[model samples]
Target: MLIYLSIISIASILCLWSEKSYKKGELFLSGFSTFLSVMVLSVFSGLRNLSVGIDITTYGKNIFETVSTFGPSVAIDYYSRWADTGYVLFNYIVSFFTGNIHIFLGVSTFVVELSFLLFFKRYRAVLDPTLSFFIFNVVTLAYSFSILRQILSMAIIIWVYYLLTKGKYLSAILLAVGSVLIHKSAVFIILIIFTCYIITKFKEKINQRYLLLLMILFTLLSTIILTRYPETIDNLIDDLNISSIQLNNFGSPMRFILFLFPVLLIKILIKEKFIQNNEEYFLYLISLITMSFGWLGGINYSLTRLTYFIIPIYILFISKKLKIINKKSINLIIIFWFFFIFWWLIGRGSEGGVIPYIPFWKEYIVF
Candidate 1:
């Protein structure tokens, strides 16, 4: 726990330095600081023992061993049966170099961190990069340690979103397909993005207030309907042929409230005219709609994972809002995040067992 906290403290200071350097027009210093910030967390995450994350020990390790053992020739059939093609292929490719699971995990962590670094770079103008990076570290990075494949998929979807904003439609579509190939869960995210995109086009035709209300109503209705008639969820999962995810687990209202908090902050920012352009507003709408899926957590906690893909954009939106909001409100928001981070990392059973922070090399000796 102390190691994790220390990493966060170090990252926070580095990000602040990056922001200060950027303000002073010191591009090289700013970029180097950002790189150092990413490396700090990445190195720590990469060096962790396989015992650090539940999935890494079981499914993650098992899959890597299977692929590396059978060699790349088995990838096609193996992936077709039980695993995501891209992720399995990744394991196969990594097998060519080294059979060490630690090395594979380190590479995976670096890739995930690189994706986030690119995301932060793309949105630097719209947000305080310091806050964006910090929020990601606090809110999402730990989860990546456990759910490697899904987080990698989410990272690809972040690129998809970035491309879409740049009007690179074909490229975005191709990358979205690749993202789904990495994790089937990405299908839900793609659907959400398409729905949001369509709505964004018609947003001017409809009143913003009513559209917001409609989204809220949709969230409420969906949650109530799914919970009351769970068969609806089961049947849909059957039809979709996606039985990999078990929606049986449920989450508390506090989790839902945490997801909702940012939406409310975005709403406040909207009223304050902080949404100066269409792209920012579009991301705001996507953030709200994505978070609305959090309400469905009552039905199946797995349903909430859909919100993960939206997190990068959500962080950027919230950071921008925080930048523009009053200092008192900012302090309150920071306090809330600190409390939430403790609750999530500590109160939530160490969040995939990332508490002890044992380096892989020292695992046997320390234990």
Candidate 2:
């Protein structure tokens, strides 16, 4: 835990320095700092032990060993029986090079972090990119150590959204399909993008408040319906061929509170006219809608993973809003929120099986 905190602190400092460089138009320094920070995180995550993540020791390791032993073709065919094509192909490619699972972990971490950094670069104009990077480190980066494949899918989704915003429709469509291949939960990205597009087109006809209210109502209705008709939900889950275990796992109150915080913050920002740009407003609204859906689907763990793809947008929107507030107020709010998220991860995030940190080198030491 101390090592994790140290890495985050160093990364945050570098990000702040990067911001200073950006302000001075020192492009090289700014880019270097950002790159160095990303490398710090990626290296730390990639070098961790196979036993570090709960899933890594069990499911992740098994997949790696299976692919390494059976050869890519057989492994791909076997995994295709259940897993998505992109993930299966990813495993095949990684395993083809070596039988060591650690190598795959390292490669995956590097790819995901690099992709995320690229996405951040593209959207730096929309927010205080440094602060956004810090927020991601504190809130989402550590969690990625546990859900590697999902995080990779999330990176692809971010790129897809960026492409859509730039009016690169064909590229966005291709990327969105790729994201779905990486993780089926990424299908929610399509819904989010489509909804945001509709909202943008009909901004004058629609009320943001009404849309939020509708989301809240939908959340309540879905929760009540699922709770009352478990059999129906089970049938739906079966038909979708999703994991049955997800039906038994519900989100905690803390998770709901974290999701709600952004909704409330966005509302306050909008009311104060802090968010005036249509595209920015649409992104925040989509974030809220996705989070609401996540909360509504809290009964199913797999469904909740859908929200992860949009969390970077939420973080960026909040970071943007904070920039317009009084410095002291922003400082206090950010400090409080950062610590709260840190506490949650150290405590409740044990479900990811990332607690009691252990380094990969430790396993090879004779001592």
Candidate 3:
């Protein structure tokens, strides 16, 4: 915890010092910095810390049963192949290297890094050319961009975007077909892509006015419906029988801060043409809508995790149009991340909880 605080302090200082360049391609150093911090902290989340709920996800424990199923479900703990496929595939490939642990990390790292690299490359053309490879692509992906199940899907989706923008329609379609096979969430994404393509095919402009207005209404309605009837939505999504994510535990009220981000972002980023010209804005808007849908889907339902599916769009939106440090946004940023400068010492991250501004009201009075 002390180390994490020190890291945050250093990053805050860095954030203060750097204004012109925040790293490159379409990502920010802050994003990568946060990821590095999480990686280090997660080392402690082993058997002793997050020792419960079975997230280790190894082949040694249940490869046979994992293969028995179609790997269709997320329940790898009960012998689902979804988690074990990567593990099983890695075991054979790593027989040439050291132990399974090294192999696991190695392949995991490669698959993730390759996936994100492809994604950054796809958007590089329309993004801030100033960001090129370092801040936008490298730092962001290096951080924590691909640390989950659906990341491969993100990579492929961006490639689909690239092909679409570059006029490689056939290739884009092929990429979408490939992506859905990797993760079922890709299916929902494919639908969004096709819908956008159809809408934009002959449209004279990006048409932000109507899209923006409708999105605002949709967001409000979704938030109200979900908060009011969390149970009903929970039952709806959970009928597939996957374990429900603990929303109450993440102190989800903190996520309301997410809504604040694009708003705060637009405060400084509004004038930038990046929001209108770039194909990515469309993707970002729809993804944000999807995130709102995820929120409305249920409580304690992995909205944070669901947000991961849209993170690239978020980062791109920031780097392209919102990376600048204005007086207002800067002040708000401190408030945004820290809430109070002493939050770690007395509030959210103050206790041993590494998750910042989360678990909502679960206060831990650290001495």
Which runs of model 1 end up more than 4 angstroms from their true locations? 22-28, 73-83, 228-252, 265-270, 274-277, 326-332, 338-342, 349-351, 361-367
Question: Per-residue lDDT tens digits of candidate 1, residues 269-357?
Answer: 55757566666666777776766765564455456456667877777777777666646566467646745754553445354456666
A best-first ranking of the candidates according to their lDDT comes to: 1, 2, 3
Off by over 4 Å in 3: 1-54, 58-61, 64-99, 121-148, 216-253, 272-274, 278-281, 290-294, 297-300, 323-367
Backbone clash tally (model 3): 15
**Which model is ahead, 1 or 3, in terms of TM-score?**
1
User: lDDT tens digits, residues 1-367, model 3?
Assistant: 2433443344334332222234443246644543443343233222121211123233332332343333324334455445234434433344445443423443444455445544553454444322322232222232231233355456667677667767898999998877665555566667766776566555666656766676668668757766786564444222323233333322334444434454455544455543554365465566556546444433434343344455555555554443443345543453344333224212332211223322212344321
Global lDDT scores for all candidate models: 0.69, 0.67, 0.44
* lDDT, residue 254, candidate 1: 51
Quality of model 3 by C-alpha lDDT: 0.44
